[model samples]
Target chain A: MQSPTRAKKKTKATSMDIAHRAGVSQATVSRVLRGSPLVNAETRRRVEEAVKELNYKVDRHASSLRTQRSGTLALLLFEDPTPDDSHINPFFLSMLGSITRACARHGHDLLVSFQQLSDDWHADYEDSMKADGLILLGYGDYLAYESKLAHLVAQGTHFVRWGPVLQGQPGISIGCDNAEGGALAGRHLVAQGRKKVAFLGDASTHFPEFFARYCGCDAALREVGLRMNPALQVDADSTEQAGYEAAQVLIARGLPFDAIFAASDLIALGAMHALKEAGLRIPEDVAVVGFDGTPMARFSNPPLSTVVQDTSKAGELLVDTLLQLVRDQPAQSITMAPTLQVRASSGG
Target chain B: MQSPTRAKKKTKATSMDIAHRAGVSQATVSRVLRGSPLVNAETRRRVEEAVKELNYKVDRHASSLRTQRSGTLALLLFEDPTPDDSHINPFFLSMLGSITRACARHGHDLLVSFQQLSDDWHADYEDSMKADGLILLGYGDYLAYESKLAHLVAQGTHFVRWGPVLQGQPGISIGCDNAEGGALAGRHLVAQGRKKVAFLGDASTHFPEFFARYCGCDAALREVGLRMNPALQVDADSTEQAGYEAAQVLIARGLPFDAIFAASDLIALGAMHALKEAGLRIPEDVAVVGFDGTPMARFSNPPLSTVVQDTSKAGELLVDTLLQLVRDQPAQSITMAPTLQVRASSGG
Candidate 1:
């Protein structure tokens, strides 16, 4: 009843057939059958159904020898030049929280560290079997890290970063829509009858994320017959001190601006302090808006109105996407939508 | 030229003599020379001096062959029943920052995870060679953790906790002086003529840290011919919602309170909102004080006056103490002093 060739090639063809029927790669089916954490819930279900539908024989011994897994993920935080000893920027705290919870849910142990001092970490972490993959978080000059990312790709390291999702980037990235967030801030301020809006952040390709925000705000303003004055745009990193200094510079330029749109909440807070020191009443004299609705925004001096990113969702997707890559599955860059939260600072 | 018996026992006795001269155990000398991160600066200095003074021949081969070390520490956070999805209590954010920096200083990688999900972590972490030691952080019922800690000691797993430093505890602990912190808050409020001071926290033996704070505040009030009225105190955990509800409950009693000292900054923030809703003016109708000098306290509506724990120092000490235990060296419970930061809420 069975053909000789079909019987001889039964195991190999059945596995391939199972992969085809499950709409997954053979590697994913192997991962699912071996109980790999890298396989997502949906993929596992599809693989299992395909096995049953094909009447595939179970090979427990072979599945047990699939590969060694540490069931661990490492989070390498590229240090922020924080104003305080808390190595984390307050903005990353919420992201860290979501990542921690996500790791727990996926049953993967998370190893956290600053990427500053560790040398050859690209080889030391995953290649040494310390973790199954790496989750990178930080804000730095994109140009400086470009070569390092290329090296990581050359080494075939499984890593995912929380940054701007750009084409031809070395690794998969899960990011909040920074450009849309900037536009949202701009649209909100324009609706409040503010004509001139000054931006606080480095608007250069060296920092792609900030550059996108700058362009997005500029585009939004142009729609209302207004464009952001590059002369009014002061370069500032994501720190209250930097923000304060940038505002002082903007004020000294003698530029008449009706409103300020900071790229970050910390920058907005610093600018607010400078404006208040200059005796400007918020919303009455200078309407202000900030991005990144961090918890601190709720308690800011005037309660900052800002663009909010769903960090929890970003974190969950980051973990899932990294796992997918670890399991040799196809994964794509993800850009999440940002919502506007209007508070006292925006004259709301 | 050496006596036959002395020559025969030379290597062993000389090592012991080095240990005796260094005023450290033989194990510590070995650890120091092997470049163990477990040894502190002072201890390593002593051992190095002893080696030079004794003219001990450096055994390169044996030193290189010292026991396997992971150069890693695991941080297990005992979860707080937080009001939000940010798994961490904001108080720990500074601590985490300090700990991360501290780990970097010692050249050790840190693995951070919630202790709630993983069962048999005591065996899973150190026993399975995941880490050399563990640094535990959380604010939970001490009664429930007491037995588990005892088991950790039984299994000879090295660990240090961030909690109240008590005598005869299962393991070493590094903690802030809670009693002193509470007294500092009470003293500041009393200086403002706040007589009827209300306390917000579960001040019971189950929560020894809060209980100590409660007693300390009560003692400070007694110094001014006043004591904490049991009716004025409300039981609340370390959450803003709990603080808000506790404040509502306190206000519902219709008892007049001139001051409120919350156990945590989050609780204080919550209570302040409730007080404002009841049309009470802060630092006028009621002076408010909180514990944990978290950054959020800076942006509170009236800027909360808080008792500041030296989280940077605490984190450093926690790592140092855990390393001491990992090296099989004698370690003690450390209690760091707390300082008060008076803000607008305290009528400063």
Candidate 2:
């Protein structure tokens, strides 16, 4: 095996070297290198073979130097309130796959890391010129992180974040219409003849996404001339344990709720387990709905019903918007539409 | 929000500038920068405040030039043979979290990307000198990718992969003892009085990890003087759908198997669904076991029993080994022991 470090010391082959080896003109070599259709397949193959033989590399650094851009983007994932050490939210993992594909499609390299909220986090990427811009995902508490976002803005950092797309939020943001998603779940449960629907997730400013979802659900219930019972709202994070404890709390309250709408699938799955342990049959007794249609939702005991965010579109838009900011172009916040995925848990 | 691009042009403050502002000597500044721990808490706090105030950067590029090393590691994830567009294996995702943390602990930046099997994939990092070394994960078919690994080896690329720790493989690898994991599962099944055990996974050389697992299970069965029924093994990939189909195949063959050991949690989950659909009570008519002990296993109905690889240890070893190779030190392959997480599905 050849040592790559030793091979790198050898001078890089130029297009002229390929042209000499392939017995083609330099212009033809350039045309082939540019992937111009003007070059025929036979000639292109010959040029490619010569290029491979010479171990040539296009000097991306030179191009980057000219543009003053690293041609890289950083993805900062904030720790989620998970039950285990992984800390990553399963929903973010799905979104990560889409974002990676989108970056590759747009000719950008991605640098992924956990969001370190310390003062030096920005210096780790942007200040070091490792990436041109940043894409933030999974802010634990929106209110707690709001000041940091403002600090980033004050420093003139080019960033886009995934969160509730509310007015006056810092920087460019891309997110699903959480309110619409909540309303969709509420309507579905109401249509199933579930009158007393309980909510499991913090519906406060600290968790803006859950709050928006709660408002939407509230509006949906009110639209049908029914008011949400405050006693049925239980605060919980997006974790199975949190959901389980919240359900226990709701059960302890002795509220006669017939349906439960968890802000996330992890929460809903935990709630289902708790309800089952309490001798309640899903859908037949207490219908359930969840947000973030993760793969686990499909395999849940009753196959959870959820509001599906368009991750592919979300990823594409996030990358595109960040690139726009990197290039000094105007980028706007975006809120994507949500679709309901009805499964056995909701009696769909 | 401040524009990061605009902030880039501002002359960055130096350690001397920080020292002057903090009313400390340049030597004291250097000591604080190196984290000598000799400095008093009050002095450290003052220096840190000054450093933050001036927005100072450590000029990583200057240090990198002195050492011919990029101070970065690349993690290449090969697309798994999954049922959906998100080709990432859940097991690898868990590994990713550990690897990321390990990199941070070692003061190295991580560059993450999906492994594109095309020829230019190596050029994406090693040839370009973007990263000092590579940590590879998830090779779908070892045989198909063997030549590529050889090419990387010939090029003197510093890389370590997660796979079966066997002789004659092209490069260094870190993996769990698949054979031991298989034997552990077999012994547990035997203890449960399950004599007829079905294996659902491709146990051939093409998938070395799974093949090792089968060999271990075979050895354990032989030790107990119980031969494995060749007709009971059904080939399937590590996916829920594939597991479901393989189980159906096993059932159709009229094999009186009381136990099923799947190659992955996904497969076991799928098999359990099929068994429930066919009205077979878990542990009464059939018991199931799986590998990769992912989060989904805990949540699966009846809960899946699985072989849990120490991903945290594996990640640390993989990073440590590759760094050894990067520093021109002798690095050896490592095999970690697996633990059996006996859950409800196996009647544990």
Candidate 3:
């Protein structure tokens, strides 16, 4: 099975060489490589060994052309540039890592791209036939890109999105229970005997995930016969810089708030930075809580208290669901539960 | 140039339709799409307009069937499983981000995968012709994988590695000045009036990057009539858990070290955690510095001081160099400089 020296002698091995090495006919080698049921088990194994030893690729283009299945998945990440220059939100990077691993586990390849919000990426990916299906991951306005998703659905493209699993969405999705995550943060803060909580993130319909989180926090606050102050809430994107700026704006409003819940971990980190710069101590002054339990959250200055979205599970499900759609299996939208990680920042 | 509605009316558009829309013969459209110099700029623009508006892919597999180039790049990230299960080093994730962007800038698609160190990934990518070239990124024993690089070279596989730019390596590489990075950490600690500086990472040829960093730091210490104590160095991988365990070992050794320099940011982060757990105050009890100016360092407890490698430039160089090789252009192994980011962790 392992013949490194043989592979080196020939720059590119043809099917004839594979057939010769396997002690089989070229037709048998083709049958084995093409996953035909006509080939016997022992003969298929032998042909595969020969293919490996000879470093033969079986002309992926020709194979894909015949089957119309490229055995590849395209991951189109809508670029959300941050001040840190990572170009991808750290939370999304973790997702990307998991998704890549899951693809390997499922025996598929992944084609990754950082796309602008305005690109006609959905149609292009399907039309190009570069992949069997698509996995959409990013941070941006849901409304802004919803039309593109509708277009994808209209054209019958197989795609799964990573965001809030909303009703009437054009495509299938795998998402965290943002409301449950926010409620957990709020209830934790509420149990700490805190009131007048401020939220940092856009709570508009454009960003439904953040909006759901806002509503969930409000519901938790309502449990204590209280409601989130509209004036205390400042709209911010899912970025540290935006979180910092939103915090500054909240501070400038001269409103008294005891606890702050950021829509995402990055926003929480930035808000914490601003709070510290303004001489506000963590937990004692403002009990700060963030979303997304990324590794970065665990190592923050006060070990940020965050709503840990199950990214590992999310990645697996995203791949699984997309593959289901690709194989014409009945795949449905999935929503995973979120949990709270109490740490120093939230008075743990 | 853009016509979304018409594209939706038809599920798939053909070359004949593009020719008709461009007001040219199918031959002219084919020449223009194939990028033959025989087609003029105005005709090319008109045909391209038709292609985009109609959302015709031109069948990537069929096109590559005629021409050898796949117009795709494969990024094989050797999985370095961290305790957090992200499966990729955060530093490498940054490089991945930049590399993905660079591929987009260069008009090439990117195929990403998490490969095991022992897998025949190098040969598979080349043999499959799934990508025009390969970009290999990961962290492990250099000697363990050096033979694999040699195998790739022997097979005339087009590849660029991300690691130490050794003078006589089998394939081309784009790397950071690791020794200089180590020197930066040593000099900074020295400037803080620290005499005893410990190092965390493997200091052997097996891990050339870490070994070079160890050597660089030792060299810097020697300039001030001092040398790194052999007892103070601990062997560890580039993971937070590894760092933590290494630091615990160092603490148990009772080596009177006043400072510590980790080989990577993950190690520093883990070491910092262990140090804090053992009732040691950062910068005061033991000044600590790390390499890899990842964003995680910027938000860590006491804001970890770290050596910064120019990953964006490295990404650009890796892609540019690989494309050069793919195009039969001259490519060379390039080394980039490193800088230090001073933070409170190192008493900055």
Model 1 per-residue lDDT tens digits across residues B236-301: 999888999999999999999999999999889999989999999998999999999988898778
The residue-by-residue lDDT of candidate 3 on B68-176, one tens digit each, is 6789999998864434666468898989999988999999999998877878686787677788889999988788898999988788788889998886778888899
Q: Considering TM-score, where higher is better, how would the candidates rank from best to worst?
A: 3, 2, 1
A21-58, model 3: which lDDT tens digit per residue? 98999989998877899999999999999887776887
Once fitted onto the true fold, the runs of candidate 2 whose alpha carbons sit more than 4 angstroms away are A1-51, A58-67, A80-83, B1-52, B58-66, B80-83
Ten residues in sequence with the least summed lDDT for candidate 2 chain A: A1-10
* DockQ winner, 1 or 3: 3
On TM-score, the candidate that comes out on top is: 3
Candidate 3 or 1, higher lDDT: 3
Error of 2 at A234 (Å): 1.7
Error of 2 at B279 (Å): 3.4
TM-score of the second chain for every model: 0.80, 0.86, 0.92
How does candidate 3 score on lDDT? 0.87
TM-score of each: 0.81, 0.87, 0.94
Tell me candidate 3's interface RMSD. Answer: 7.5
Candidate 3 segments whose C-alpha is farther than 4 A from its true place: A1-11, A20-25, A40-53, A80-84, B1-11, B16-25, B37-53, B80-84
Q: Pick the DockQ winner.
A: 3
